[model samples]
Target: MKNLDLKKHYIFFIGEELPQPEAHLVQSTNAANAAANLGYSTVLVYLQKGLKAIKPANLARPFQPRETPTELVKYYNLHDKLKVVPLPMPWPIDNFRSKFTDSNTIASKYYLPFHILPTTKLVHSRNWNFVKAAIKNGVPAIYEHHHHEDKPFELEIVNNPLLQIAVTVVDSIRETMIANGMPEDKVIRLHNGFNRLFMQRQPEKAAEWRQKLLSNERSYLVVYAGALQQFKGIDVLIDVAIKMPNVQFVCAGGKPPEVEHYQQLTKEKQVQNITFLGYVLHHELASLLQAADILAHPHCSGKAATFTSPLKLFDYFASGTPIVATEIPSLIEFKDTRAIAAWCEPDNSHKFAECLKQVLETHPRKIEGYSDSIEFVKQFSWENRAAKILSYVEESLRPLLIT
Candidate 1:
């Protein structure tokens, strides 16, 4: 490619096409960042992969690796100004060998053997090569990681003299990468921000969803929106549901069979007032947040759940609702230790229930107490986050600036 002007920046994302919250944050923020800076253009290059297992296959099937990139191109409406580069690397095999491979046999394998490679080779090949080219030509590129532990071995690629990585959350990951011999300077942590749309609370939309939950049910609603999995500690939440029959626990987001089984347990346990609305669209999330009195995330297990920050928290804060979270390192940002959110034991149902009750009795949706988070959130706004990212890109491209 030609060497474009050094002032502009580009972001290269290597992951599944499913529009996860973090991806939305990156895309929205970068665009806002570009718009704020005036002359700069931010390009989002999405590499194609199968729908993530967490989301239902029915929804995932249509947007296979080959088809999804086009949707993003059209979705963003980024035909003329924005560039969408689609690189279809075979699963498992794509993990091990780079596109610049010597043998066709190895390349044909596509999927990389997980246990052997530990790291995905194809990611390094296509993702790294893209970053390397951009960096060489004085353009700053971001290799984003939506989830943690998915790329612990990405240390090699992130630390490579060629690319820059934008990782979410900074709890244990910062230490983990440094211990793995990655330079502290190489990894940049961009805490996921709330969608710009959420900044302006759409009360009418909120009211519509509010009616859906409160109609013929209960007034006080407690919502948990995210993955339905063991690591999410939804089982503990179910147990809490059994204890608090009055509080309607509305479970939303993608659910696997095991998560569905948790729902069964709620029924088996005979816990009433727990409703599950399987996957929800992005627009609906805000209304749901507005309708709820609390945003509960009882995730207790997995590196992805524990160390990685929940993008939902940003929305929760944006919603102006009080939050109740399990004690996790990544959630330290929201933790006041003494006050604010009601924190409980990781997987203890009794403690979770107690915390929920305490929060309900105490924090009654007052905007003043949560002002810090609201103000903190101002920093995490898409425009501000983008500007910060733009600064990083400019800094990265500083040495190559041919004055």
Candidate 2:
């Protein structure tokens, strides 16, 4: 193991085991990679407990050091500059708790503050406990909030003088934090972004995927590329698929169990047009979105639906494909924007199907008022997102340094 410099920026997340197909992991890794590329020495620290228990193949070579940048690059499409550090929970306790509780909670709250925070120059994380710990231990911290959760300690933590910034993905979240007694100036809203290197117009690759997915009968391909949870509107997508038998539908993400369950549901319903291509790699996603005639974001109405920022939305925009999405609060801003091709009420499968059909039929011919999508999505690249956030952090720290 190489000695880590305390001057480097440390981004910590008590995440799931490595290389898992999860959105949060994607966001954190991309931020770290971008920060490193921007010439900041950055290290991404995540928990790797339960790997031996969950993935038996790891037992062949037990508890090796952190995965190399090469391995991470292959798995995450990361650049070579970023450093990844995986921390393991205590041995016997981890084995016992792995069955009953989330190891992330224990490790983040108890282990990380004492072992990792003291060595970090600046800490950035999504975990509330980890961020709180960093501030408590006298390290400058940044908290990135993604969801609308009721945390009792949130107000105290965000208001702490040691905390440099609180970043939210939507304006509503920043508003909520301010209403709950957080300092107005300390919080800012910045949306998620897409990987520009991969998520661009790839005409030749798009044609290849179109050749494979489309047939003589089914000329159009509609895609939904995200988690296959009920709240994510997979059920609504299934209902829409039932209504539109002529349009070929494909889902590009989900865990194995979720994929199996959805597959059975579609089978029971006797729906023949929809297929689940579970857990497509990040780099391959752009070509898949490019291959689509229309992209679907059928999120159902819920607490998560109100404030959630779906990473797939940006990726869909980057592909330059027309988008059909539910008019949830978080996504409503894009309704009038050129990014979305069509919009419908949340969880209304009939309306969703009708909207998708209208877009599919009218596309390849401009959709009247909407501008060019590729040009519209140019500002939402991952590098640009990271640069903006880091600039904010630097500005906030400048006065302290001057004194």
Candidate 3:
């Protein structure tokens, strides 16, 4: 096969601040890495969604601090071809275009492209200007969907000629775009990838980490990580704790005021063995996932949940742990029972309990399944993602320029 090499210019649209040290931010950073590996020059511009202004101590770290520094610009060398740009001011439409066209050798650079309205809660007036300018510049704009609210905005932005890609993890999100009249060919369905440092860690190390979290007392440990929102089905988890006094349940995420109040429900229900570790760094999160016997993703939604692809799903797979999640179409794509995570109804406490019980009862099966999942997930590695993205980049750039 002929290798098509071109120094194609890529502008990664991060609606939020860069170097915020969050998983979503890291995923965007890695996308830049993937771009560079394909022999393209990638520029990641952070729109500064108030994350840069927050002082380090004032903000909570998401995972254990590793190579990603807690500073405003967290940089790593995915490849020599990558460069990250962080804008301290609001998304400056004029400044972005001028820089991209004049300074950067790419097509006239424009503001970081993004959109949201009254329906998509993510939109701010400041960012709307940037989105408009990118459309006007004829830049290849891409919108990433981290939540369900982004669905409508993704549709709206597709109207612009600059709309080249819509990256979403949830399988059902495609319907949302179709409902809003977007062609299927315009979008890309790329799920998130784990950092090599976390994905390739030794199993023995994982076992050791698991031991530290559970100690010798608990026979089984169940972990649920994310914000303690109502849609998260955290109450169902608490109910499980009450039903099964013998099992230890651990909840990891940021402690919201409502969640703090929800702790009262846990106490009232007399679920004492539950441990709450507020948001941890990604590395620390891996250790927590390693420690758990199974991961519980009890997100429940009659409407909003359909369009979301939680980052934790792939993270759980990367950890090589069995998952008991709600039957979201986003998860249906991975249906291998051996490596496949369990699915149950989110609000149905009995169903959730039974799913967990099955995992516990079939202890050997669970172990074998986890082992298989670890192997299966190897194909979904960052290296593989880099390869797939390069394929698209090569195809896109070949006719215009060739090496």
Candidate 4:
């Protein structure tokens, strides 16, 4: 957050708690923390009510838990640079009884009065109505748009004169917005970034976890670290594991039920050499990636795969280890026209497994375009992403904030 103009950056996220385990919540925290690191005064306002407001949990401060805790932690700051405000439900109505179309109509009225500074600009990544509400209230703001496949960008959102900019995570999403009538200049395409933890030294516990995953220390290991969703092609990963018995496959994500579901599938297939260490925490995942021989991301095509910038892929990149991923634009971009990853079109299990084997067996000297990817990944750092968003606001939306 250095060399930037001095201004408070209001980041509104319509959620609760410090680390809720959802990708969006974690990223929102990252974005705000990065903004504060970039030298901006950042305020992270959680609009949800009924917060417990406990002391910041020091238990595994750096690691993000895989599941939300039953405990209540209403307030916590990020590095003491970002102020956190968890506003209890503003209305007497319970969430169960509330007729909320969106957070904007329900919560925007509360934002102005209790907001950090009335004059500051805002960057919101929650619901569209919140951004729309902010714009309606004359608060200069940009909406961070995640992927949406159901319908094209609505005419009202794209054509809104008050809506100055939209920050999307992938180029495909930016194109979608443009096709839906957003001006090319008004869209910012910032890819998801790896948490800095991945780039750090491997934890001392790596050897223990490695041995736990592989009884035979000599066996090769590949890991998939993301949620277990049907579209994610977890089934493909299972098939690959079944085909390759010598190579150990470890999956680290998903709820207990999801893990049990996969466990049952593995049993039916009689899969060997694969372990599901369900829901590894964020810090735990870094060492897990480092301990592995390869990072395998086998997500086949779908709307989720099409528009998402998977945080795990970048986590894999930061591991500086090899990756063998399904053919997808997002992963291919990480390849950066190089052989940094074994990018293969795996319409079937055999093809995907073959690609993995090729990556594992190929002579080290034969792989091409490896250096470019490592270089390409450096710019996608969360700090840089945050700085860019803040810089854009300072230059483009500052005047609009004069309300």
lDDT tens digits, residues 1-403, model 3?
2222222345554556444435565666766555555554445555333545243542232111122234432232244445554443423332466643232222113223221110111111113334445555444445555454343454456675555545566666655655656667765677776554445545565567556555456668889877777777888788877776677888877545655777777778667877776655565666667667778988776775776556666667777777888876666566655665567866888888888889877643232236666776677666576556445432543212111
| Runs in model 4 lying further than 4 Å from the true structure | 1-7, 16-18, 47-80, 90-94, 100-104, 112-119, 149-162, 363-374, 396-403
lDDT of 3 at 378: 72
Q: Between 3 and 4, whose TM-score is larger?
A: 4
Q: Per model, how many backbone clashes are there?
A: 12, 0, 9, 6
Instruction: Judging by TM-score, tell me the better candidate of 1 and 2.
Output: 2
Tell me each candidate's TM-score. Answer: 0.69, 0.85, 0.71, 0.80
What's the best-to-worst order under lDDT? 2, 4, 3, 1
Per-residue accuracy of model 1 over 162-240 as CA lDDT, tens digit each: 4544544565766665555556786677676666444456667766776777646466788987777678777788888
lDDT of 2 by residue, 23-46 (tens): 888888887777777776567776
lDDT of 3 at 123: 12
Residue 276 in model 4: shift from native, Å?
2.0
CA error at residue 318 for candidate 2, angstroms: 0.4
Model 3 residue runs over 4 Å out of place are: 1-9, 18-26, 36-39, 47-82, 90-132, 146-162, 202-212, 215-217, 255-264, 364-369, 386-403
Tens-place lDDT per residue, model 4, 1-403, is 3313333355555545444445676667667666666665555666443433222442112111122122222211134454555544433434355446333444555544344335356656556666766666755667787776445656766666656678888888888878876778889888877667676656465666677888663367788888887778789899888788888999988778888999999999898677888867676777777777777888878667777667777777776667888877666665554535577774577888887788777623211223444555677788888767666654645422211
Residue 211 C-alpha lDDT in model 2: 88
Which candidate has the highest lDDT of all?
Answer: 2
